[model samples]
Every structure is written in structure tokens, then in C-alpha cells.
Target: MGADHAERVAHRVSGARLVAVSDADAARAGDLAARFPGVRAVTDPLALVADDDVDAVVVASPGAAHEEQVLACLEAGKHVLCEKPLTMDGESSLRVVRAERAAGRPLVQLGFMRRFDPEYARLKAVLDSGRLGRMLLLHNTHRNKSVPDTFRSEMIVRDSLVHEVDVARFLFGEEITEVTVYSPAPTSAAAEGVVDPQVSVFRMQGGAVVTNEVFVTNQVGYEVRCEAVCERGSAMAGRPWADLYTTVAADDGEGLWGGGVPADFLGRFARAYDLELQAWADASRRGEVVGPTTWDGYAATVVCEAGMRSLTTGEPASVTLVDPGPAS
Candidate 1:
């Protein structure tokens, strides 16, 4: 994902060069660097930060490693763009927020690419225009073909549907106060002893109800859809990759048609990825916080954690927000 971001940023912004690339796998880093000529490959991220030549950093490592990498970059006095689920939990997210505040600048941007997507932006504009007449309900669906065996248990909430959590917060323009988790039946595709599909219901502070269903056995394709039903009207968005084709038989039949689903998430979100990186690069260069802020990331983490707890205890979990660090 970091490599993809770099390529998109390079394409969108002129005079922007990738100076260094790093990965735990030295061979992968070297290969990425080779793809972008004149870029240096390094095994250590610290080396990239220590170098005086590099201007900023993009943290696309796994979720568990994000807090440390983001804080490290901030301490090194470099701007950073870290991928979603900024940290494993709210506590670590707060630490990153504090580190940014202590740095005396907005150094970290969370990679919530939906904020930059055209459809989502359009939805936000419509909602902000007051045409929605007080958003009453929000429904989001995030389904995937399958997750790795190790990721079966909690990844649905943390990694997959977390995007919906963030988007729900953004769309409603309010915080979630409580969440309830419902586990349907386990599917054959899910690993043994894991919940394959889960539904999360949230009550927003402003009396809006939100529900998200994360299903893991969509062998057909990857799907993402959202609908905001308001008193005035309804706005809906989704990704439907149905292809139509027509073929006539030997002067005997009218026509034959077919369609297929998009293979995976990367294909569906390719444009969003490009837009996300371009906005981040532009914002970083202009010294502005353009994409999702660390605070937003922290808030999403809080909601996800609450949902997870609700799943475990078979109860509705509540979310509490502490004071954001001193004004930046």
C-alpha cells in the first residue's frame, strides 16, 4: 500500500520524488526502490528518518506497529501519513496524539481514504447542505470473500468493518454513544471457532441509529455500500461491478449476456487510494492537515474497541472520550 501511495503521489504532483523506501524484507524494499530509479532502499525505517535528505514519512506497516512508527517519525521531526486503525486501541492512539501535540505541529495524518473519495465527498456535501433534514439512520455493509485463518476471529471488526465505523462517524457528524454486537450463524468459510459474520448496531449522540454488517463469505466479490436515510430524502452509494455483454446466435437467438463481480478490495479502492495519497502529499507540502486527523483515528479506535467488548460480553458497550491534548 505504501508503494502504491508513493506511485500515485508521484503521478499527481510534479517535482515530487521518492527518496527512500524501507521494509522488513530487504529484498522487497530493494525491489521497490529499483522500480523507482534513484530511490534508495533501506532495511531500517530509522535510517530513513535519520537521513537529512528525506522530508516526510508514510507508515503503511501492520496495525500493531503503527503507533510506534508514527511516534518515531514525529520525534524525528518528520511529517507522517499512517494507515487506518491508527493503533490497536484508544490508549495508544492518545499517545500518538500527544506526541504530535508535543511536536508543536500536525505531523501525523491517518490514512482514511474514504474521506477523499468522490462519492463520499459528494455525500458529505449533500448532508452539510441541510437537505438531509437531520440524518435519522445510517446503514453500512462491508463484506469480503475471506480473511486469513489467523485473522478470522477479530479482524472482521478491527480491520474490515472499521472503515464503516469511521465513515459512520463522519457521515452523522456525531459521536457514537453505545454499540451492540450481534453474531449470526458461523459460515463454513470461517475458521473453526470463529464468528464469520457480525452485525454492530450503534446509537449516535444525536439520536441517530447506525448499523453495520460485516460478512466474510461473499465468494462472489468484494462489496461496500452505504445509505443515509433522512427525513427529506435518501442518498445511497455502492460499488457494483457487473459487466454486460451481448452475443447473437447464428441467426437463431436474440442475444446472450453475462456479468461477473470484481475480484477484491484493491481493485475496488484503487481510485480512492490514488486520491488519498495525492491529498496527503499536497497537504504535507503545504503544511496543512488535509486528510483524516489523528483525533479521528483515535475516535474510530474507541468505537471499534467498544464494539469488540460488546461482542465478547453479549452487551451493549458505551464509548467515552477524554480531553484532546492541549491545543496545537
Candidate 2:
């Protein structure tokens, strides 16, 4: 993700310059920096944040490193675009939110790129238009072909399902008040002791309901889909509406016709990432922050933390958010 963001800022996003790249591995950073003209490699992340030439930053580091690095960016008064979770837990995410509040301006934009995806944007527009009446439910499906051995059951909730949590909030225009996670039998491709598929039900403050099916070991393809069910109508994204309609002779009358899915999220959301980075860059150049804010990130983290607890206790958990006071 770090490499992907660097490439976007350097070659794609306008009004932004990839002045420096940082990694714990100096050689890796140097190699990546060598790909772009005048881009320097900074071995230490803190030094990268403190670099005199860096006016803004993109934090694609591991979630655990987010709090410190984001705090460093706030301390330096640089606008930052931090990837999902904001931090590993709600407490840490709240701290980052407080820091941003203390800065007296919005400087942190979260990397919830799906919000920038054209399909989702249109869906949001439809919901807001009142043509759908009132959105009552949202159904989301997040499936990956596979994952690393290190990816665990908890990560299924924290990382993959977290996207749907934000989607619910974005579409419903309310906080997720509760979460109930259900884990069925693990798929054959699942790692030992890891749940491959997790079903979560999110209750919104507006009395709307959202359901998410997160299956990381689907062994099919990377598919991210969402459907909004409103009082009068419905809309969906990532429905694989193919250009051709045909029935292959190999399948006889089985009626198997659908577009191919991407191998991973990077392929599916490439354009979204580009748009998101472009918007962030455009906003940062004006000394303003846009897109998903730190509070949104923190709220998602709080919901995910509750979902994790539900995974353990096999019960629904209530989402509790600490209000950041006025001026949030």
C-alpha cells in the first residue's frame, strides 16, 4: 500500500509531490525512491514526517505505527492521509482525533477510498436524493481470494469488515450503535484457527440495519459489493454487470454469466485510490482537509472493537463512542 500510494502521488495525483519515501528498511526505501526523480529515501519515519520539504504526508504504515506517526504529522502541522483504522484500537484512534482537534483545524483524512468509488458515490447520491425514500438497510459483501497465514479471525473483523462498518455510517448518516458478529464453519482454504467468513449485523442510530458478509478465503475472486435497500427502491454496486450476455456450451443451460473479478483490492479500487489521493492532494494544497475525517476513522475503530468482542463472546456488542465535544 505504501508503494501504491507513493506511485499515485508521484505520477497520478496533481498538485502533490512525493518528496520522500520512508521504511524501516533503508534499502527498500532507497529502491522505491529511486523509481521517482528527486524522491529521497528517509530510513526513519519520524524524520520523514519532520522533513523540511514535506508539506503533507500519506501514512500507509502498519496500523500499530499510525498513532505515533500521525501525532508526529500533527505536531509538525502537516496534513496527513492515514489509511484505515487510524489506530489498532478505539482508545488510540480517539487520541489521534484529540490531537487533530487540538491542532485547531482538520488535518487528518482517512483512506476510506470506497467513498470515492463512482458506484458508491452515485449510490450515496441516490440515497440523499430521497428518491429511494428512506434507506432502511444496507447489505455488503467483502470477499478475498485468500490471505496470508498471519491474518487471523480478529483481523477479519478489524481489517476486512471495518470497510463495511464505514459504508454503513456513510450511507445511513448515523453512528453504528451496535454490532453482532457471527462466524460459521471455516472454509477449506482458511488458515488454522482462523475464521474465513464473518457475518456482522450493524444497528445504526437511525434504526437502520446493515449486514456485512466478510469472507477472506472465498477462493473465488476479490469481490466487494454493496446494496442499499430503501423504503421505496434499491441500488447496488459491484454487481458485475457484464457487457456480453451468453450461455457457454460447456455449461449447457447452467446459465453461468458474470464478469471476471479482480485478483485483489488494488485492482478493484485502483481508480478509487487515484481519485481519493487526487482529492486529498487538492485539499491539502489549499491547507484544508477533505474526505473521511479522523473522527470517522475513530468511530469505525470503536465499532470494530465491539465486533471483535462479539467474535469472542458470540453475542452482540454495543458500540460506544466518546464524543469529541463541539467543533468536531
**Per-prediction TM-score:** 0.92, 0.96
Which portions of model 1 show Cα errors greater than 4 Å?
10-15, 239-258
Tens digits of lDDT, candidate 2, 1-328: 9999999988998888889999888899999999999999998999999999999999999999999999999999999999997999999998888889988889999999999998899888989999989898899999999999899999999999989988999988889999999989988889999977989899999898899999998988898989999889899987767343354444456656554678899998999999999999899889998889999999999999999999999999999999876554
- How accurate locally is residue 163 in candidate 2, as Cα lDDT from 0 to 100? 94
CA lDDT scores, all candidates in order: 0.81, 0.91
Across 1-328, the per-residue lDDT of candidate 1 in tens digits comes to 8778666655555545688889888998898888876888988888787789988888888888888788888888877889988999999998888778878989788888877777788888898899778889998988887777887657778887789888888888788899888888888788898887888899999989998988877576777878899999988766342232334354566554444445676776777777777777777788877768889899889888888898898899999977765956
What residue runs in model 2 are displaced by over 4 Å at the alpha carbon? Answer: 242-256
Q: State in Å the error of residue 323, model 2.
A: 1.4
Candidate 1 matches the true fold with a TM-score of 0.92
In each prediction, how many residue pairs overlap at the backbone (N, C-alpha, C within less than 3 A)? Answer: 0, 0
